[model samples]
Target: MGGLLGVLLVWRVASALFGGGEPGLPSGGGTPASPTPTDDGGNGVPASTVEVAEDFPLPAIGTRLEFKILGLGDDPKRCEAVGLLVGDDQRTAYHHLCGDAEAGTDVYFFLVRIVNHSDAAQPIALASFEMTADGGDTLPALDVETANATREHYFPERIELGPDSRIKKFVAFDGSPPFTPARLTYVDGTQALVIHLRGTWIGA
Candidate 1:
Protein backbone atom coordinates (compact mmCIF):
# COMPACT_ATOMS: atom_id res chain seq x y z
CA MET A 1 0.00 0.00 0.00
CA GLY A 2 2.75 2.41 0.89
CA GLY A 3 4.63 1.64 -2.33
CA LEU A 4 1.53 2.10 -4.46
CA LEU A 5 0.71 5.42 -2.85
CA GLY A 6 4.30 6.54 -3.39
CA VAL A 7 4.16 5.73 -7.12
CA LEU A 8 0.84 7.49 -7.61
CA LEU A 9 2.11 10.46 -5.64
CA VAL A 10 5.05 10.71 -8.02
CA TRP A 11 2.75 10.57 -11.02
CA ARG A 12 0.48 13.20 -9.48
CA VAL A 13 3.39 15.47 -8.77
CA ALA A 14 4.67 15.03 -12.31
CA SER A 15 1.27 15.85 -13.70
CA ALA A 16 1.23 19.06 -11.67
CA LEU A 17 4.74 20.06 -12.63
CA PHE A 18 4.17 19.52 -16.35
CA GLY A 19 0.51 20.57 -16.52
CA GLY A 20 -0.36 17.36 -18.31
CA GLY A 21 -3.77 15.84 -18.82
CA GLU A 22 -2.61 12.28 -18.10
CA PRO A 23 0.67 12.16 -16.28
CA GLY A 24 3.45 13.02 -18.77
CA LEU A 25 1.13 13.39 -21.77
CA PRO A 26 0.09 16.87 -22.86
CA SER A 27 -3.55 17.80 -23.30
CA GLY A 28 -4.82 17.16 -26.83
CA GLY A 29 -7.71 15.84 -28.85
CA GLY A 30 -7.32 12.19 -29.66
CA THR A 31 -9.17 8.96 -29.20
CA PRO A 32 -6.82 7.30 -26.82
CA ALA A 33 -6.36 3.58 -27.16
CA SER A 34 -8.01 1.27 -24.73
CA PRO A 35 -6.16 0.13 -21.60
CA THR A 36 -4.96 -3.44 -21.48
CA PRO A 37 -5.30 -5.56 -18.40
CA THR A 38 -2.37 -7.13 -16.61
CA ASP A 39 -1.54 -9.21 -13.58
CA ASP A 40 -1.57 -6.69 -10.74
CA GLY A 41 -3.37 -6.28 -7.43
CA GLY A 42 -6.19 -3.71 -7.32
CA ASN A 43 -6.35 -2.86 -3.62
CA GLY A 44 -9.48 -5.03 -3.25
CA VAL A 45 -10.80 -4.04 -6.67
CA PRO A 46 -10.69 -6.65 -9.41
CA ALA A 47 -7.49 -6.76 -11.39
CA SER A 48 -9.31 -6.63 -14.71
CA THR A 49 -10.82 -3.28 -13.81
CA VAL A 50 -7.38 -1.83 -13.10
CA GLU A 51 -5.97 -1.40 -16.55
CA VAL A 52 -2.44 -0.51 -17.60
CA ALA A 53 -3.31 3.03 -18.62
CA GLU A 54 -5.33 3.74 -15.52
CA ASP A 55 -3.91 1.60 -12.78
CA PHE A 56 -5.18 4.15 -10.32
CA PRO A 57 -7.92 6.05 -12.08
CA LEU A 58 -8.93 9.31 -10.51
CA PRO A 59 -12.42 9.49 -9.09
CA ALA A 60 -14.44 12.04 -11.04
CA ILE A 61 -16.68 14.60 -9.44
CA GLY A 62 -19.98 13.04 -8.33
CA THR A 63 -18.70 9.53 -8.90
CA ARG A 64 -19.68 7.10 -6.17
CA LEU A 65 -17.21 5.35 -3.94
CA GLU A 66 -17.27 3.89 -0.46
CA PHE A 67 -16.22 7.35 0.70
CA LYS A 68 -16.03 9.50 -2.38
CA ILE A 69 -14.42 12.91 -2.59
CA LEU A 70 -16.68 15.06 -4.69
CA GLY A 71 -14.72 18.29 -4.78
CA LEU A 72 -12.12 20.57 -3.22
CA GLY A 73 -11.23 24.27 -3.19
CA ASP A 74 -8.26 26.05 -1.62
CA ASP A 75 -8.21 29.47 0.00
CA PRO A 76 -4.48 30.22 0.28
CA LYS A 77 -3.76 33.43 2.08
CA ARG A 78 -1.90 34.83 5.09
CA CYS A 79 -4.21 35.85 7.94
CA GLU A 80 -6.92 36.22 5.35
CA ALA A 81 -9.96 38.24 6.39
CA VAL A 82 -13.50 37.26 5.50
CA GLY A 83 -17.08 38.00 6.39
CA LEU A 84 -18.95 35.80 8.83
CA LEU A 85 -22.64 35.41 9.52
CA VAL A 86 -23.75 36.30 13.03
CA GLY A 87 -27.20 35.17 14.17
CA ASP A 88 -29.72 35.96 11.44
CA ASP A 89 -29.42 39.70 11.11
CA GLN A 90 -25.73 40.54 11.03
CA ARG A 91 -22.64 39.71 9.02
CA THR A 92 -19.18 41.08 9.72
CA ALA A 93 -15.78 40.93 8.12
CA TYR A 94 -13.11 39.74 10.48
CA HIS A 95 -9.79 37.92 10.50
CA HIS A 96 -10.54 34.23 10.54
CA LEU A 97 -9.45 32.28 13.66
CA CYS A 98 -9.19 28.78 12.26
CA GLY A 99 -5.43 28.43 12.75
CA ASP A 100 -2.25 30.20 11.84
CA ALA A 101 0.01 29.09 9.03
CA GLU A 102 3.66 29.08 10.00
CA ALA A 103 5.51 32.36 9.49
CA GLY A 104 6.63 32.68 5.89
CA THR A 105 3.91 30.19 4.95
CA ASP A 106 0.27 30.47 3.91
CA VAL A 107 -2.78 28.69 5.24
CA TYR A 108 -4.95 26.77 2.77
CA PHE A 109 -8.60 26.22 3.45
CA PHE A 110 -9.66 23.11 1.53
CA LEU A 111 -13.36 22.84 0.96
CA VAL A 112 -13.91 19.12 0.51
CA ARG A 113 -17.14 17.33 -0.29
CA ILE A 114 -17.49 13.63 0.32
CA VAL A 115 -20.16 11.04 -0.30
CA ASN A 116 -20.81 7.57 1.08
CA HIS A 117 -22.11 5.11 -1.48
CA SER A 118 -21.92 1.81 0.31
CA ASP A 119 -24.80 0.05 2.02
CA ALA A 120 -23.12 0.34 5.41
CA ALA A 121 -21.89 3.36 7.29
CA GLN A 122 -18.29 4.53 7.28
CA PRO A 123 -16.22 6.81 9.46
CA ILE A 124 -14.74 9.91 7.82
CA ALA A 125 -11.64 10.64 9.84
CA LEU A 126 -9.77 13.82 8.99
CA ALA A 127 -6.53 11.96 9.72
CA SER A 128 -7.15 9.78 6.69
CA PHE A 129 -6.50 12.71 4.40
CA GLU A 130 -3.39 14.86 3.96
CA MET A 131 -1.75 17.33 1.62
CA THR A 132 1.50 16.15 0.03
CA ALA A 133 4.04 18.84 -0.75
CA ASP A 134 6.70 18.93 -3.45
CA GLY A 135 9.41 18.17 -0.94
CA GLY A 136 7.74 14.79 -0.30
CA ASP A 137 6.67 15.74 3.21
CA THR A 138 3.01 15.74 4.24
CA LEU A 139 0.87 17.99 6.43
CA PRO A 140 -2.07 16.48 8.24
CA ALA A 141 -5.44 18.18 8.39
CA LEU A 142 -5.79 20.67 11.21
CA ASP A 143 -7.52 19.64 14.44
CA VAL A 144 -11.27 20.23 14.56
CA GLU A 145 -11.14 22.43 17.67
CA THR A 146 -8.75 24.97 16.18
CA ALA A 147 -10.57 24.85 12.88
CA ASN A 148 -13.99 25.29 14.46
CA ALA A 149 -12.83 28.39 16.29
CA THR A 150 -13.03 30.25 12.97
CA ARG A 151 -16.76 29.49 13.00
CA GLU A 152 -16.47 28.68 9.32
CA HIS A 153 -17.56 25.39 7.86
CA TYR A 154 -15.22 22.64 9.03
CA PHE A 155 -15.22 18.87 9.22
CA PRO A 156 -15.20 17.31 12.66
CA GLU A 157 -12.23 15.18 13.73
CA ARG A 158 -14.27 12.16 12.88
CA ILE A 159 -17.85 11.49 11.82
CA GLU A 160 -19.98 8.75 10.44
CA LEU A 161 -21.54 9.12 6.98
CA GLY A 162 -24.59 7.04 6.26
CA PRO A 163 -25.00 5.12 3.05
CA ASP A 164 -26.09 7.19 0.07
CA SER A 165 -25.52 10.36 2.05
CA ARG A 166 -23.15 13.21 1.31
CA ILE A 167 -21.36 15.99 3.18
CA LYS A 168 -19.31 19.09 2.53
CA LYS A 169 -16.89 20.86 4.85
CA PHE A 170 -13.65 22.77 4.96
CA VAL A 171 -10.26 21.30 6.03
CA ALA A 172 -7.27 23.44 6.82
CA PHE A 173 -3.63 22.75 5.96
CA ASP A 174 -0.52 24.87 6.32
CA GLY A 175 1.09 25.52 2.99
CA SER A 176 4.83 25.17 2.33
CA PRO A 177 6.26 28.04 0.33
CA PRO A 178 8.98 27.36 -2.26
CA PHE A 179 7.61 23.82 -2.17
CA THR A 180 4.45 23.42 -4.20
CA PRO A 181 1.75 21.06 -2.98
CA ALA A 182 1.41 18.03 -5.25
CA ARG A 183 -1.85 16.48 -4.23
CA LEU A 184 -4.46 15.69 -1.58
CA THR A 185 -4.60 12.00 -0.76
CA TYR A 186 -6.93 9.83 1.31
CA VAL A 187 -6.02 6.36 2.40
CA ASP A 188 -8.06 3.66 4.09
CA GLY A 189 -6.00 0.57 4.69
CA THR A 190 -4.88 -0.69 1.31
CA GLN A 191 -7.35 1.36 -0.67
CA ALA A 192 -6.32 4.82 -1.75
CA LEU A 193 -7.70 7.82 -3.62
CA VAL A 194 -5.54 10.49 -5.19
CA ILE A 195 -6.56 14.07 -5.93
CA HIS A 196 -4.17 16.04 -8.11
CA LEU A 197 -4.28 19.61 -6.84
CA ARG A 198 -1.00 21.32 -7.46
CA GLY A 199 -1.74 24.35 -9.63
CA THR A 200 -5.51 24.56 -9.13
CA TRP A 201 -8.41 23.24 -7.07
CA ILE A 202 -10.97 20.77 -8.38
CA GLY A 203 -14.76 20.48 -8.10
CA ALA A 204 -15.56 24.04 -7.14
Candidate 2:
Protein backbone atom coordinates (compact mmCIF):
# COMPACT_ATOMS: atom_id res chain seq x y z
CA MET A 1 0.00 0.00 0.00
CA GLY A 2 2.82 2.40 0.76
CA GLY A 3 4.40 1.86 -2.65
CA LEU A 4 1.02 2.24 -4.31
CA LEU A 5 0.45 5.54 -2.54
CA GLY A 6 3.86 6.81 -3.59
CA VAL A 7 3.18 6.00 -7.22
CA LEU A 8 -0.20 7.70 -7.01
CA LEU A 9 1.41 10.81 -5.54
CA VAL A 10 3.96 11.07 -8.33
CA TRP A 11 1.29 10.62 -10.94
CA ARG A 12 -0.73 13.52 -9.56
CA VAL A 13 2.21 15.91 -9.56
CA ALA A 14 3.05 14.94 -13.11
CA SER A 15 -0.48 15.56 -14.27
CA ALA A 16 -0.55 19.00 -12.64
CA LEU A 17 2.66 20.00 -14.37
CA PHE A 18 1.99 18.73 -17.90
CA GLY A 19 -1.73 19.42 -17.86
CA GLY A 20 -4.37 17.53 -19.91
CA GLY A 21 -5.54 20.18 -22.34
CA GLU A 22 -4.28 20.87 -25.84
CA PRO A 23 -1.12 22.95 -26.16
CA GLY A 24 -1.65 26.75 -25.98
CA LEU A 25 -0.40 27.31 -29.51
CA PRO A 26 -2.30 28.44 -32.53
CA SER A 27 -3.93 25.65 -34.52
CA GLY A 28 -4.32 27.18 -37.95
CA GLY A 29 -1.53 28.11 -40.37
CA GLY A 30 -1.69 31.85 -39.68
CA THR A 31 0.25 33.59 -36.90
CA PRO A 32 -1.28 34.28 -33.52
CA ALA A 33 -2.74 37.73 -32.84
CA SER A 34 -0.67 40.29 -30.99
CA PRO A 35 -1.57 40.78 -27.34
CA THR A 36 -3.65 43.91 -26.86
CA PRO A 37 -2.28 46.65 -24.63
CA THR A 38 -4.39 47.26 -21.52
CA ASP A 39 -2.66 50.42 -20.30
CA ASP A 40 -5.38 53.00 -19.58
CA GLY A 41 -3.31 55.23 -17.28
CA GLY A 42 -5.65 54.38 -14.38
CA ASN A 43 -2.67 53.44 -12.22
CA GLY A 44 -0.55 56.20 -13.76
CA VAL A 45 1.48 53.55 -15.60
CA PRO A 46 1.04 51.74 -18.90
CA ALA A 47 0.19 48.01 -18.85
CA SER A 48 0.35 45.46 -21.64
CA THR A 49 0.96 41.78 -22.24
CA VAL A 50 4.47 41.04 -23.30
CA GLU A 51 4.24 39.78 -26.86
CA VAL A 52 5.70 36.35 -27.33
CA ALA A 53 6.58 35.50 -30.90
CA GLU A 54 3.88 33.44 -32.60
CA ASP A 55 6.25 30.55 -32.97
CA PHE A 56 7.27 30.54 -29.31
CA PRO A 57 5.95 27.32 -27.87
CA LEU A 58 4.45 27.46 -24.41
CA PRO A 59 6.39 25.54 -21.79
CA ALA A 60 4.81 22.18 -21.07
CA ILE A 61 5.07 22.49 -17.29
CA GLY A 62 5.90 26.08 -16.37
CA THR A 63 4.45 29.53 -15.62
CA ARG A 64 5.05 33.09 -16.87
CA LEU A 65 5.38 36.27 -14.80
CA GLU A 66 4.66 39.79 -16.14
CA PHE A 67 5.59 43.00 -14.31
CA LYS A 68 3.56 46.22 -14.05
CA ILE A 69 4.41 49.79 -13.07
CA LEU A 70 2.49 51.40 -10.21
CA GLY A 71 2.72 54.96 -8.84
CA LEU A 72 3.94 55.24 -5.28
CA GLY A 73 1.06 56.70 -3.34
CA ASP A 74 0.89 60.51 -3.57
CA ASP A 75 4.66 60.80 -3.69
CA PRO A 76 5.45 61.46 -7.31
CA LYS A 77 9.10 61.08 -6.37
CA ARG A 78 8.71 57.38 -5.49
CA CYS A 79 7.82 54.39 -7.67
CA GLU A 80 6.03 51.17 -6.83
CA ALA A 81 6.58 47.86 -8.59
CA VAL A 82 3.60 45.70 -9.49
CA GLY A 83 2.84 42.84 -11.90
CA LEU A 84 0.62 39.85 -12.67
CA LEU A 85 0.60 36.57 -14.55
CA VAL A 86 -0.24 36.71 -18.26
CA GLY A 87 -3.13 34.27 -18.49
CA ASP A 88 -5.46 32.00 -16.49
CA ASP A 89 -4.25 28.80 -18.12
CA GLN A 90 -4.08 25.92 -15.70
CA ARG A 91 -0.70 24.37 -14.84
CA THR A 92 0.96 27.73 -15.56
CA ALA A 93 2.50 29.79 -12.75
CA TYR A 94 1.97 33.55 -12.39
CA HIS A 95 3.97 36.18 -10.49
CA HIS A 96 4.50 39.85 -9.56
CA LEU A 97 7.62 41.86 -8.68
CA CYS A 98 7.60 44.09 -5.61
CA GLY A 99 10.19 46.18 -3.80
CA ASP A 100 10.84 49.26 -1.69
CA ALA A 101 14.02 51.16 -2.41
CA GLU A 102 13.64 53.38 0.63
CA ALA A 103 13.46 50.26 2.77
CA GLY A 104 16.36 48.68 0.89
CA THR A 105 14.30 45.70 -0.12
CA ASP A 106 13.24 43.94 -3.32
CA VAL A 107 11.27 40.73 -3.71
CA TYR A 108 9.24 38.57 -6.07
CA PHE A 109 5.74 37.60 -5.09
CA PHE A 110 4.77 34.57 -7.20
CA LEU A 111 1.09 33.85 -7.37
CA VAL A 112 1.03 30.19 -8.35
CA ARG A 113 -2.39 29.33 -9.68
CA ILE A 114 -2.76 25.62 -10.12
CA VAL A 115 -5.70 24.13 -11.91
CA ASN A 116 -6.25 20.41 -11.89
CA HIS A 117 -6.75 19.65 -15.58
CA SER A 118 -6.41 16.00 -14.79
CA ASP A 119 -9.05 13.56 -13.61
CA ALA A 120 -8.08 13.40 -9.94
CA ALA A 121 -7.23 15.79 -7.13
CA GLN A 122 -3.64 16.89 -6.86
CA PRO A 123 -1.81 18.01 -3.73
CA ILE A 124 0.89 20.70 -3.91
CA ALA A 125 3.43 21.82 -1.34
CA LEU A 126 5.53 24.95 -1.06
CA ALA A 127 8.63 22.80 -0.82
CA SER A 128 8.19 21.92 -4.48
CA PHE A 129 9.03 25.47 -5.61
CA GLU A 130 12.46 27.13 -5.60
CA MET A 131 13.83 30.57 -6.59
CA THR A 132 17.38 31.31 -7.75
CA ALA A 133 19.30 34.42 -8.83
CA ASP A 134 21.88 34.97 -11.56
CA GLY A 135 24.82 35.09 -9.16
CA GLY A 136 24.19 31.45 -8.24
CA ASP A 137 22.25 32.53 -5.16
CA THR A 138 19.54 30.13 -4.10
CA LEU A 139 16.96 32.30 -2.36
CA PRO A 140 14.64 30.88 0.25
CA ALA A 141 10.96 31.71 0.33
CA LEU A 142 9.76 33.39 3.51
CA ASP A 143 7.49 31.40 5.77
CA VAL A 144 3.85 32.36 5.89
CA GLU A 145 4.15 34.23 9.17
CA THR A 146 7.26 36.12 8.11
CA ALA A 147 5.87 36.94 4.69
CA ASN A 148 2.62 38.23 6.18
CA ALA A 149 4.52 40.42 8.62
CA THR A 150 6.60 41.92 5.85
CA ARG A 151 4.00 42.37 3.11
CA GLU A 152 0.27 42.82 3.05
CA HIS A 153 -0.04 40.18 0.29
CA TYR A 154 1.13 36.64 1.01
CA PHE A 155 0.14 33.01 0.57
CA PRO A 156 -0.09 30.19 3.04
CA GLU A 157 1.73 26.86 2.99
CA ARG A 158 0.50 23.72 1.10
CA ILE A 159 -2.59 23.50 -1.10
CA GLU A 160 -4.74 21.01 -3.00
CA LEU A 161 -6.81 21.64 -6.11
CA GLY A 162 -9.58 19.38 -7.34
CA PRO A 163 -10.19 18.52 -10.98
CA ASP A 164 -11.54 21.48 -12.99
CA SER A 165 -10.84 23.69 -9.98
CA ARG A 166 -8.03 26.14 -9.26
CA ILE A 167 -6.29 27.80 -6.34
CA LYS A 168 -4.07 30.90 -6.24
CA LYS A 169 -1.48 31.78 -3.60
CA PHE A 170 1.58 33.96 -3.16
CA VAL A 171 5.13 32.79 -2.56
CA ALA A 172 7.55 35.48 -1.35
CA PHE A 173 11.26 35.59 -2.15
CA ASP A 174 14.11 37.90 -1.06
CA GLY A 175 16.54 36.48 -3.58
CA SER A 176 18.39 39.30 -5.32
CA PRO A 177 19.03 42.98 -4.77
CA PRO A 178 16.21 45.36 -5.57
CA PHE A 179 15.58 45.29 -9.36
CA THR A 180 18.52 43.00 -9.90
CA PRO A 181 16.77 39.66 -10.06
CA ALA A 182 17.89 37.33 -12.85
CA ARG A 183 15.83 34.15 -12.92
CA LEU A 184 12.99 32.26 -11.21
CA THR A 185 12.73 28.48 -11.02
CA TYR A 186 10.26 25.82 -9.95
CA VAL A 187 10.61 22.05 -9.76
CA ASP A 188 8.22 19.17 -9.09
CA GLY A 189 10.59 16.21 -8.78
CA THR A 190 9.94 14.94 -12.30
CA GLN A 191 10.14 18.26 -14.24
CA ALA A 192 11.68 21.72 -13.86
CA LEU A 193 10.44 25.21 -14.87
CA VAL A 194 12.75 28.19 -15.33
CA ILE A 195 11.75 31.81 -16.11
CA HIS A 196 14.60 33.96 -17.35
CA LEU A 197 14.79 37.69 -16.53
CA ARG A 198 18.33 38.54 -17.56
CA GLY A 199 18.91 42.13 -18.75
CA THR A 200 15.39 43.09 -17.64
CA TRP A 201 14.64 46.16 -15.53
CA ILE A 202 12.00 46.13 -12.82
CA GLY A 203 10.30 49.53 -13.35
CA ALA A 204 11.29 50.18 -16.92
Candidate 3:
Protein backbone atom coordinates (compact mmCIF):
# COMPACT_ATOMS: atom_id res chain seq x y z
CA MET A 1 0.00 0.00 0.00
CA GLY A 2 3.00 2.32 0.39
CA GLY A 3 3.27 2.70 -3.33
CA LEU A 4 -0.39 3.52 -3.61
CA LEU A 5 -0.16 6.04 -0.80
CA GLY A 6 2.85 7.60 -2.46
CA VAL A 7 0.85 7.87 -5.65
CA LEU A 8 -2.02 9.45 -3.69
CA LEU A 9 0.38 11.81 -2.03
CA VAL A 10 1.67 12.66 -5.44
CA TRP A 11 -1.90 13.47 -6.48
CA ARG A 12 -2.53 15.67 -3.47
CA VAL A 13 0.68 17.53 -4.13
CA ALA A 14 0.28 17.62 -7.88
CA SER A 15 -3.27 18.88 -7.58
CA ALA A 16 -2.10 21.63 -5.31
CA LEU A 17 1.00 22.33 -7.37
CA PHE A 18 -1.10 22.56 -10.52
CA GLY A 19 -3.90 24.46 -8.77
CA GLY A 20 -6.92 22.20 -9.24
CA GLY A 21 -9.08 24.44 -7.18
CA GLU A 22 -12.35 26.27 -7.70
CA PRO A 23 -10.90 29.72 -8.35
CA GLY A 24 -8.36 27.93 -6.17
CA LEU A 25 -9.59 24.44 -5.23
CA PRO A 26 -12.44 22.70 -3.42
CA SER A 27 -10.71 22.30 -0.04
CA GLY A 28 -10.26 26.01 0.49
CA GLY A 29 -12.39 25.83 3.63
CA GLY A 30 -10.39 23.16 5.44
CA THR A 31 -7.14 23.47 7.36
CA PRO A 32 -4.40 24.67 5.07
CA ALA A 33 -3.14 21.26 3.95
CA SER A 34 0.62 21.44 4.49
CA PRO A 35 1.58 18.62 2.23
CA THR A 36 5.25 18.29 1.24
CA PRO A 37 6.56 17.01 -2.07
CA THR A 38 9.53 14.66 -1.80
CA ASP A 39 11.93 13.52 -4.51
CA ASP A 40 13.26 16.36 -6.54
CA GLY A 41 13.71 14.00 -9.50
CA GLY A 42 11.18 11.39 -10.60
CA ASN A 43 11.61 7.63 -11.16
CA GLY A 44 14.24 8.24 -13.83
CA VAL A 45 11.47 8.25 -16.43
CA PRO A 46 11.03 11.00 -18.92
CA ALA A 47 7.85 13.06 -18.73
CA SER A 48 7.55 12.72 -22.47
CA THR A 49 7.15 8.95 -22.11
CA VAL A 50 4.02 9.28 -20.03
CA GLU A 51 1.22 7.67 -21.94
CA VAL A 52 -2.55 7.62 -21.58
CA ALA A 53 -4.12 4.39 -22.75
CA GLU A 54 -7.36 5.31 -24.50
CA ASP A 55 -8.85 1.91 -25.31
CA PHE A 56 -9.47 0.53 -21.87
CA PRO A 57 -13.15 -0.41 -21.74
CA LEU A 58 -15.55 1.32 -19.43
CA PRO A 59 -17.44 -1.04 -17.15
CA ALA A 60 -20.83 -1.57 -18.73
CA ILE A 61 -23.24 -4.46 -18.83
CA GLY A 62 -22.33 -6.95 -21.57
CA THR A 63 -18.75 -5.67 -21.45
CA ARG A 64 -16.23 -8.06 -19.92
CA LEU A 65 -12.77 -6.58 -19.71
CA GLU A 66 -9.77 -8.78 -18.90
CA PHE A 67 -6.66 -7.41 -17.25
CA LYS A 68 -3.63 -8.61 -15.28
CA ILE A 69 -1.31 -6.64 -13.07
CA LEU A 70 2.10 -6.78 -14.66
CA GLY A 71 3.67 -5.32 -11.53
CA LEU A 72 2.57 -5.00 -7.91
CA GLY A 73 3.99 -2.67 -5.29
CA ASP A 74 3.18 -1.77 -1.70
CA ASP A 75 4.08 1.38 0.23
CA PRO A 76 1.30 1.92 2.72
CA LYS A 77 -0.88 2.04 -0.41
CA ARG A 78 -0.47 -0.59 -3.06
CA CYS A 79 0.68 0.20 -6.62
CA GLU A 80 -0.41 -2.09 -9.40
CA ALA A 81 0.58 -2.04 -13.10
CA VAL A 82 -2.20 -3.86 -14.90
CA GLY A 83 -1.64 -5.34 -18.36
CA LEU A 84 -4.37 -5.84 -20.89
CA LEU A 85 -4.60 -7.73 -24.16
CA VAL A 86 -7.76 -8.51 -26.09
CA GLY A 87 -8.57 -9.67 -29.59
CA ASP A 88 -5.73 -7.81 -31.37
CA ASP A 89 -5.78 -5.12 -28.67
CA GLN A 90 -2.54 -3.76 -27.19
CA ARG A 91 -3.46 -0.44 -25.58
CA THR A 92 -3.28 -0.10 -21.78
CA ALA A 93 -2.37 2.14 -18.82
CA TYR A 94 -1.20 1.67 -15.25
CA HIS A 95 -4.07 1.46 -12.71
CA HIS A 96 -2.60 2.89 -9.52
CA LEU A 97 -4.17 3.79 -6.14
CA CYS A 98 -3.18 4.53 -2.57
CA GLY A 99 -5.01 2.83 0.34
CA ASP A 100 -5.00 4.10 3.88
CA ALA A 101 -6.80 2.77 6.96
CA GLU A 102 -6.94 5.58 9.45
CA ALA A 103 -10.20 5.91 11.35
CA GLY A 104 -12.25 8.92 10.15
CA THR A 105 -9.47 9.98 7.85
CA ASP A 106 -11.85 10.59 4.90
CA VAL A 107 -9.32 9.71 2.23
CA TYR A 108 -9.85 7.77 -1.00
CA PHE A 109 -7.42 5.03 -2.09
CA PHE A 110 -8.51 4.74 -5.68
CA LEU A 111 -10.50 1.57 -4.97
CA VAL A 112 -10.75 1.45 -8.75
CA ARG A 113 -8.81 3.39 -11.35
CA ILE A 114 -10.22 5.00 -14.51
CA VAL A 115 -9.20 7.64 -17.01
CA ASN A 116 -11.11 10.36 -18.84
CA HIS A 117 -10.80 9.97 -22.62
CA SER A 118 -14.09 11.38 -23.79
CA ASP A 119 -14.47 14.84 -25.28
CA ALA A 120 -17.79 15.47 -23.63
CA ALA A 121 -18.30 14.33 -20.07
CA GLN A 122 -19.91 10.95 -20.69
CA PRO A 123 -22.42 9.40 -18.32
CA ILE A 124 -21.06 6.27 -16.63
CA ALA A 125 -22.33 4.47 -13.53
CA LEU A 126 -21.17 1.58 -11.41
CA ALA A 127 -23.19 -1.56 -10.67
CA SER A 128 -22.67 -3.60 -7.54
CA PHE A 129 -20.93 -6.55 -9.12
CA GLU A 130 -19.54 -9.93 -8.06
CA MET A 131 -15.95 -10.68 -9.14
CA THR A 132 -14.05 -13.92 -8.72
CA ALA A 133 -10.49 -13.74 -7.37
CA ASP A 134 -8.06 -16.56 -8.26
CA GLY A 135 -10.89 -19.03 -7.80
CA GLY A 136 -14.51 -18.49 -6.72
CA ASP A 137 -14.58 -16.10 -3.77
CA THR A 138 -16.69 -13.23 -5.07
CA LEU A 139 -16.20 -9.56 -4.35
CA PRO A 140 -17.86 -6.36 -5.48
CA ALA A 141 -17.24 -5.97 -9.18
CA LEU A 142 -15.31 -2.79 -10.11
CA ASP A 143 -18.20 -1.26 -12.08
CA VAL A 144 -21.73 -2.61 -11.92
CA GLU A 145 -24.80 -0.52 -12.71
CA THR A 146 -27.77 -0.96 -10.36
CA ALA A 147 -25.85 -3.17 -7.97
CA ASN A 148 -22.93 -0.75 -7.86
CA ALA A 149 -22.53 0.50 -4.35
CA THR A 150 -20.35 3.49 -5.32
CA ARG A 151 -19.89 6.05 -8.08
CA GLU A 152 -17.56 8.94 -9.08
CA HIS A 153 -17.64 11.22 -12.07
CA TYR A 154 -14.73 12.93 -13.88
CA PHE A 155 -15.87 16.24 -15.40
CA PRO A 156 -12.68 18.13 -14.78
CA GLU A 157 -13.15 21.88 -14.72
CA ARG A 158 -10.29 21.63 -17.22
CA ILE A 159 -8.96 18.85 -19.52
CA GLU A 160 -5.87 20.20 -21.22
CA LEU A 161 -3.71 17.25 -20.09
CA GLY A 162 -0.55 18.95 -18.84
CA PRO A 163 -1.81 22.36 -19.92
CA ASP A 164 -2.79 22.94 -16.31
CA SER A 165 0.47 23.11 -14.40
CA ARG A 166 -1.52 21.81 -11.42
CA ILE A 167 -1.90 18.40 -13.04
CA LYS A 168 1.78 17.54 -12.55
CA LYS A 169 1.26 13.81 -12.52
CA PHE A 170 -1.50 11.32 -13.15
CA VAL A 171 -3.69 12.55 -10.31
CA ALA A 172 -7.03 11.42 -8.89
CA PHE A 173 -9.16 12.59 -5.97
CA ASP A 174 -11.97 10.70 -4.31
CA GLY A 175 -15.52 11.85 -3.64
CA SER A 176 -15.27 15.52 -4.51
CA PRO A 177 -18.63 16.84 -3.29
CA PRO A 178 -21.64 17.82 -5.35
CA PHE A 179 -20.90 14.73 -7.41
CA THR A 180 -23.78 13.78 -9.70
CA PRO A 181 -23.48 10.05 -10.45
CA ALA A 182 -24.91 8.54 -13.62
CA ARG A 183 -27.15 5.47 -14.13
CA LEU A 184 -26.43 2.07 -15.63
CA THR A 185 -27.97 -0.56 -17.97
CA TYR A 186 -27.96 -4.31 -17.43
CA VAL A 187 -26.61 -6.86 -19.88
CA ASP A 188 -30.08 -8.07 -20.74
CA GLY A 189 -30.93 -4.47 -21.54
CA THR A 190 -33.01 -4.33 -18.36
CA GLN A 191 -32.65 -1.96 -15.46
CA ALA A 192 -31.16 -3.85 -12.57
CA LEU A 193 -29.49 -1.45 -10.15
CA VAL A 194 -30.42 2.18 -9.54
CA ILE A 195 -29.61 4.96 -7.08
CA HIS A 196 -26.61 7.14 -6.22
CA LEU A 197 -23.92 5.70 -4.01
CA ARG A 198 -22.42 8.60 -2.14
CA GLY A 199 -18.70 9.48 -2.07
CA THR A 200 -18.34 7.81 1.29
CA TRP A 201 -19.42 4.55 -0.33
CA ILE A 202 -16.33 4.67 -2.58
CA GLY A 203 -13.99 5.98 0.14
CA ALA A 204 -12.82 9.59 0.33
The lDDT for every candidate, in the order shown, is: 0.42, 0.37, 0.24
Order of candidates by TM-score, top first?
Answer: 1, 2, 3
What are the per-model C-alpha RMSD values against the true structure?
Answer: 14.1, 16.2, 19.5
Q: Which 10 successive residues of model 1 have the least lDDT summed?
A: 6-15
Residue ranges of candidate 1 with Cα displaced over 4 Å: 1-105, 176-178, 198-204
Task: Give lDDT tens digits, candidate 1, residues 70-125.
Answer: 22112323233332222332211112222332335444454456667668777787
Q: In each prediction, how many residue pairs overlap at the backbone (N, C-alpha, C within less than 3 A)?
A: 0, 1, 25
Candidate 2 on 1-204: residue-level lDDT in tens? 232222222221112332232334434522323333333323212233222221112322322221111111111122233322234322222222222322334444444444455666666656655555555556655555532142323444565657666554456565235434444444433333334443323232
Comparing 2 and 3 on lDDT, the stronger one: 2
Estimate TM-scores for all models.
0.50, 0.47, 0.24
Question: Of models 1 and 2, which has the larger TM-score?
Answer: 1
Model 3, residue 111: displacement in angstroms?
A: 12
Error of 1 at 175 (Å): 2.1
Error of 2 at 29 (Å): 15
Model 3 shows how many backbone clashes? 25
